[model samples]
Target chain A: MISIKDLSKVYGDNVVYSHFNLDIEEGNVLCILGESGCGKSTLLNILAGLTPCEGDIPKLRTAYVFQEPRLVPNLTVLGNLRLIGADEDAARQMLASVGLDGLASRYPRSLSGGQAQRVALCRAFLFPADLMLLDEPFSSLDLRLKISVMQVFKRLRENKRITALFVTHDVDEALCLADRIVVLGSGGIAGDFSNTPSEKYGGNSPLRERLFALLSGN
Target chain B: MKKYLAENAYNLAASLLAVVAMWLVWIIAYAAVGNDYLVPSFWGTAEEFFSLFAQAFFWQAFAYTLLRTAAAFLISFALGLVAAALGVAFAPFSRFLRPIIAVCRTLPTMAVLLLILVWTSPKTAPIVVTVLVLFPVIYSQLTSSISGVGGELAEMARAYRLTARQKLSKIYLPQIAPVTVAQTGANLSFGIKLTISAEVMAHTYTALGGLMSEAQTYYNLPRLAALTLCAIFAGLIIELIFRLISRYAFAWQRRAEA
Candidate 1:
């Protein structure tokens, strides 16, 4: 239900994206995979209308999770969610779903990095949005934390069926969370593939090998 | 609870020790000077302090000075907060107002007091001078704290689409509150002291400073010492009250640290 065409972004003699185009279907989890500085986050910001860019984006209410949790440091976890209009009960329930149930009254400074990211996830899920944009949301997580958070994302998507555009560089992260993965090269889409985790093979899977090779610049 | 009581008891002991040390120095000086006009004995000042408690005039003067302090503080604090908010919200306006605020901050208190005395009524001079002296303190503290709010957090607030009220109460207010409380607590005593100094010069009626001036004219060193102690106590009390408020207001912060 979302499409971008001829989107361009420039910052003082540096061009990040030139005539880039992308499309995301309704209720699909699309992960835009890219290396650092390849405009994965810029694309998300353009979609969120946070960055000034030449593009046409759908006027949809979108919730965003930055690379940092960006939780208000002075507010309790519940208060941060409430800042986005979540009632105590709904916020508590979502916090529970994300394994942060009893941390509602805790301030952001007291939380571990992984727990804080989970709170950000809970925030995005708690706020009913037409589309959720996550920018490298799991880049800081360890393997165990990453798996746990990815599971939470999977569960939230399964339950809500919300359209989400996830921006990240990790190939494994995209494979775990995305229904369709689009690899973002320097200027635009370089590799786009349909991903179904249950049906995809292990070890020598052609799709996985291709993705790994593309990421390693083979 | 035991620990809390122990801490209070320790504080009381320390204060008593300090008071004893002060009395020892006072006695030594009194011995050396041997003149009540120049250096009053500790017992003489103590007598004056007790006598002043029963005198209605002394209480009236004390009340008058305290009321003036409260008025000056409220006016300065309110206007300072408003100015700081305006400065933070509008950059061009802040730039326009910066030199004026800087003048207030850097100008000598006595000079500002003299200017106010010349331009304003003596009755209002102390309050006006207090504001001129203290407003910059509150303004700078607030503006700096507000500016310290990170851009990333602002972006987060926008992404969440928080209402203006929500953004303030939830984010900006909380972020600045600790610093505001600290600045207010530290400056309040100084503001009150400046108010008294202005009052002495302005000849504001029924104020502690006017009483002090009268004592000085009469060469009543014991009464002057008693009055000075009273002023110090009043300042201590104000600082204590603000400390209590800061403690209660930031109890959540304490909890997080714990």
Candidate 2:
């Protein structure tokens, strides 16, 4: 289990998190749903060790999928994967898994928005990391592309049994991918719910209604 | 292929038109002055320019001057790159360098040349002065370019835990190469002009500035104009060479943009 205990983070006059505590089970996909400025990204950054926090945070190798693909423009798709120590065959295999096959030699400029994000997903899975920290990785995609890319992400995450903390403001995204969903509010986690197989597929289940109410209240 | 050829032809014509316009201005100025000593006729300067190609001493001086400019440029480029890299790595060092760069930028060229000539040999003074003047410019350019390497990309690299070598080769270098190459062309051209001015101030013999000084003393207006023209031509040639190199070296950048 990855644990964050008594995590305190401040930025100038703004107090983002104070003595926040959370425990994540191994191989569990925890989706953090929150409105803007609710410290969702800060929590992920703390977990990824990108932000300094005063707490006992576990040291684990992390793979990050940012809002933007963040691929090196000059590097080919495979080359970007290779940058983080992915071997040729593993990178190629991972690319194929994300439906980016035959684009190993293509640069990021050539890839469409959805395609680039898929490569980013491929890169995250290819890395030998204990945890994956995704910061609204699909926020920029249109609905059609978002669904397509989410499907790709779901397939890869299940195949790898990735322990990921997905941060998003989209309730549908949280329901579809998250094994457990936590809604971050001004105070702390305002709502927590387990996403069973039945609730995961339901379009407007009681759980979804509850989450929407919790989010709107926060 | 046809479009490429047509584009090249148009560029060539545009360049020629500019040259012709300059020649016309020079002709007009010469006619108005009607004094060979002040503004030599275009043909007179052209004759002297062509005659310079036949002189062994002129060629030797030309070669020496070119060598000095090139040496100054290379040294300044290397030093600027190292300093910029250091500045990027350490914030305090960057702060420290800010004042030094300001001093270099604002130093009086003639005073610095005089001080350098007293401290070093005349032959070396011009190169030293040129380096001092050019280093800060190059350093500023490089610092901005290196810093401009996207913050997002850097964060991604750090999150991935890429090794230092991998980060440098895969991220820093590629991101900065195209901009650096483009700026280098302008920097080298400016370096040549500075070197020549320093050489004249230092009274360095066996150099283009020395030849210009000799021509001025003899009141050979045509030769002086020819020497000035030669320096301009050298600057143009250096700029063109570097521009071509940048185009060839970073073709992928263009392709990506396209």
Candidate 3:
């Protein structure tokens, strides 16, 4: 249960947002979809309380997956999860979910890009936060590794029933991972779509045509 | 082979040129003066040097001086590392100690010497001065090494909620060791010069400084030259020892650079 009203962020002479609004219901996976530099991450940081912007956000425990892994370089894969108060078993399970089961003792520098980002994801899941924020956490991943991480996120979503706001420039990623998708354009919140992946249609169904038409005001 | 030689060519050349220039100067000056009094002939100094290598007393002095230097290094290193660790973990307390460290750093060696000479025995005077002069250098190096570890990793450690001791050994310690080891050569050399100089002044019986002093008093120019050259050789040995340490203790650095 999170809500934002009339949120705006300005940096020097640049205006990232003016009166931007978002409402996240419980157990919903909402993604802020946008092109690069559309301030999706700035909005996520604001919600994480890592940045100050004009808005009143509901106070709740939150975990964020930054664009980079942001895992502690010195810590082992398990250790990062331990930071979020995960116990030995929960940390192991979360790492296993991300296919990092055997990497518990390895440091961030020792991990591959995808593995490190997955460790960051495991950290977020392990935190037991009511709200999760992901800012293009999978951007650096290749197509093969990206699918595995997406599956891990899907499992996390199914289990936690936690409200989440993931930001990404890729529409396909937004489609596959989100329960509801909000497209942020030059004006912000250009289109909001209810995404439902079922037995009938895979959520990974391409929305390129519809989204392009929608964004272009066609 | 080419890359290896290319990398070290400058150092090798410079070292060779320095030896050649020193040899040339000695030969020309000895011939021109035609006197062993002004500056002993290179052959005379070399003979003294060769002769001293077989002398038990010379070896004993050399051994004692080296042992004291090693002892001073170890003691000062531990003190410096601990103080730095405390400083990094608790900045407020460190800030409180900052002025004290500054006073130690800036206080005159003569002042330290004159002050400590009052209490310590003549034999211990040089060791005490070495520790005092070296303590500041080492402590200051540790302080910077601690600070140079920077805030990002520290915050990461905090988020991990590491225990006080865990934070020190894991996050803080490794990051600074390479830097601390780097400061060792400069600090050791600093300590060596001061300690040996003090030894010369205090006339300690069991020191290389005492040997130099004895040479000066007896007008044994060859012995003085020989001892001076021995000190230089000892210094180069020290540098080589630390270079080997740098290779191992800072393996992470070697990896990154490689």
Task: List each candidate's DockQ score.
Answer: 0.54, 0.54, 0.20
Candidate 1 residue lDDT tens string, B43-107: 99999999999999999988888788878888888888788888989999899889998898888
Those runs of model 3 whose alpha carbons end farther than 4 Å from true positions after fitting are A1-64, A70-173, A181-218, B1-14, B32-34, B86-95, B249-251, B254-258
Ten-residue region with minimum lDDT total, candidate 1 chain B: B249-258
A-chain TM-score of every model: 0.93, 0.96, 0.91
The candidate 3 chain A region of ten consecutive residues with least summed lDDT is A197-206
Which residue pairs in candidate 3 collide?
none
Let me know the DockQ for model 1: 0.54
CA error at residue A206 for candidate 3, angstroms: 11
Q: Model 3, A32-149: lDDT tens per residue? A: 8877888988887677666688866666667777777877655567877775578999899877766779989776777778888788877877776778888898888888788777
Q: Estimate each model's TM-score.
A: 0.91, 0.94, 0.71
**lDDT of prediction 1:** 0.83
Highest TM-score, which number?
2
True contacts kept of each: 0.55, 0.57, 0.10
Candidate 3 lDDT by residue in tens digits, B42-81: 8889999999999999999988887778788888888877
Candidate 1, B-chain TM: 0.89
What residue runs in model 2 are displaced by over 4 Å at the alpha carbon? A197-202, B1-16, B255-258
